[model samples]
Target: MDNIIKANQFIQEGKLEEAAKILNEAIQENPNDTVAYVNFGHLLSIIGEKERAIAFYQKAIEIDQTMATAYYGAGNTYYDQEMFEEAVGMFKEAIANGLVEADAYFMLGLCYYNLGNLPHALANLLTATEKNPTDIDAMFQYGLTLAQTEQVDEAISVLEKVIKLDENHADAYYNLGVAYAFKEDIEKALASFEQALKIQPGHLLAGNGKKQLEALL
Candidate 1:
């Protein structure tokens, strides 16, 4: 097998030192191997060496400006560090460079949401859900964003989809309850909160929502 493949195997096996040695040798043999550099960056990132990982990703980008994977790697590191603005820029660059993965759109949505750009967040999250309909997290985020924007009916619909996707998704039920409450449908809200509590008895938000709604009714 190729050195890169062997290094990837070592990485999957949690042998970081061996993987690093092989990747270093690969880079030494062919300095222009952008793939090797990007893989090394990803391995370093996984091992908590964020600075080193960014360095390797930068090197890969320097070698090949159109390498979307390198930009995506750097974006992930920035996102993990809570540098939402930088992550948003990097993810946009990755998309511009032809990266069409749902994860890229999802991260972009999360970044925009964190930056308080609700419209952009909703747009990207909508795309993410379209790209991967089975992504429960993306659907949940989309529902939450809709609720935040006062689109309570749309939020209820999206959150219901999440519950349909995973019956035990207590958070989805909780959010659905919130949406129903916003719509002034006390009975439906109470039912949604009860379902959430049934699924997760310790769900504080659901418990509180149920109590509040009951008191109001």
Candidate 2:
């Protein structure tokens, strides 16, 4: 439909009001158009009307219970609001309904992390990385999670992989240094922290790490 296409175009152009208007009319004309409901909900969310957006998303799901994207969109909104448990439930439902993106698993990992379920967090985050190897944030979180559980060697291994991916990654280097320090490999830790400083002169963690290493010298 031209209205549907126009609404999407308006959304892309940041004309959320126009998009919402068109989508609302389109849905009224064809109440069964799940895409219209989803697009309208997305536009409402962009315009900061979260409650209205959620209402429309619910309508979309009511029309098509198997609409995985609708579940994902609602889950993302819940996650953004820091409602971790609700987000986890919605994401799990989305996945069960066939939403097979890495993002679903990644968000599940974050929810588990916040809830202090470290082992589950690691498992979900690792699954996320396996699904999308280029997921930088997932790798970083995985490394951090490993460190939290005293798996220093595994943490270092994961962070080192991040370094191989991006040599200038200051945080990865800093974390790697911490992992090495936890392992009592002072020399390697100092070298890693110093390398981080080379990339980011004002890196607070690297600077502190360097000073601590120097104290040992």
Candidate 3:
């Protein structure tokens, strides 16, 4: 346990080799320590040894099927590799094993989104937003998902909330413009697009949107 704590400190300090050495020692001393395995998996992930990270996480899951963190770690590794199908199962397992963090739900929703399962993505993202109402990223993504699923009014409302929470969220304004455009509110859409361009001068989408809306006027 001391070794693991020391290893974690080393990890935080960016002394990865030192952390690895200490973690190896910890694993040698107690091969059955799930905590050590999970920490090692996280270290491997950080170092871009994604396959090794998955192996370590799987080992932890093998020893304790109810290890929520192991499943969550594996889910992240798979997600990083763009293996959304595999990541979906891992995230679902993590949730079933008692990892109900909003982040977990958000990742699960992302996996569903990537896999083109819009209904499920919407459902999970809704849960994620409910779990953490102030999470701007989740709320923003949920707004996009709503628009994708043809919920234009809901998307506008959520995007508005995101803008209220962080006035500099250019993407939120851009998407709000799209939502308003979809609802046939030309002036509101143009105003939203202009606000987005004001916040982010480099926003090509907003620029194009502004030009298109201006042409309509």
Candidate 4:
């Protein structure tokens, strides 16, 4: 089997040191292999070697300017470091290079959300959900962005979808309660909050929401 494949199997089997050794040897044997470089970068990132991961991603980019995975890997590292602006640039580059994964769009949305660009964040998150309807995180973010933009009804609908996707999604239930409260549907809001707390005992937001609803009643 190929060294990259073997390394990937090792990684899946939780043998990080073996995987790292194989990847390192593969890089040394084929320095120009962009895929190997990107995979190695991802492994390094998982092990908390953020700087080294970015360096490997940069090396992959140097070898193949059109390597979208390399750009996306580097963007993820930047995001982890809280460098939202740099992450936005790299994610956009990945998109421009034809990386159409939901994760790329989701990360771009998160970057825009972090930068307080609500419209752009909504747009990207909406696209991410469109690309992968089953991605609960993307759906949750899309719902949250809608709520932030004051689209309360739409936010409720999206949050409901998230709840359907994962019944135990406490944050979705809490956000749904918030949306219902914004619409002055006090009874529904209280019920949603109760559901959230039921799923995640002692959820602070759910508890607060329930208290506020009770006071209103």
Q: Over 4 Å off in model 2, which ranges? A: 1-6
| Model 3 lDDT, residue 195, Cα | 93
Measured against the true structure, the TM-scores of the candidates, in listed sequence, are 0.96, 0.90, 0.97, 0.97
Residue 11 lDDT in candidate 1: 95
Q: Relative to the true structure, how large is the alpha-carbon lDDT of every model?
A: 0.94, 0.88, 0.94, 0.94
Candidate 1: segments with Cα more than 4 A from true spot: none
Q: Count the backbone clashes (under 3 Å) in each candidate.
A: 0, 0, 0, 0
lDDT of 2 at 199: 98
Once superposed on the true structure, which residue ranges of model 4 sit more than 4 Å away at CA? Answer: none
lDDT of each residue in 125-177, candidate 3, tens digit only: 99999999999999999999999999998888899989888999999999999
Q: What's the C-alpha lDDT at position 205 in model 4?
A: 90
TM-score preference between candidates 1 and 3, better one: 3
Indicate the worst ten consecutive residues by lDDT in candidate 3: 21-30
The residue pairs in collision within model 1 are: none
Better of 2 and 4 by TM-score: 4
lDDT by residue (1-217, candidate 4, tens digit) is: 3889999998888899999899888888888988889989999998999999999999999999999999999999999999999999999999999998899999999999999999999999999999999999999999999999999889988999999999999999999999888888898999999999999988999999999889978
List, residue by residue over 70-115, the lDDT tens digit for candidate 1: 9999999999889999899889999999998789999999999999
Off by over 4 Å in 3: none
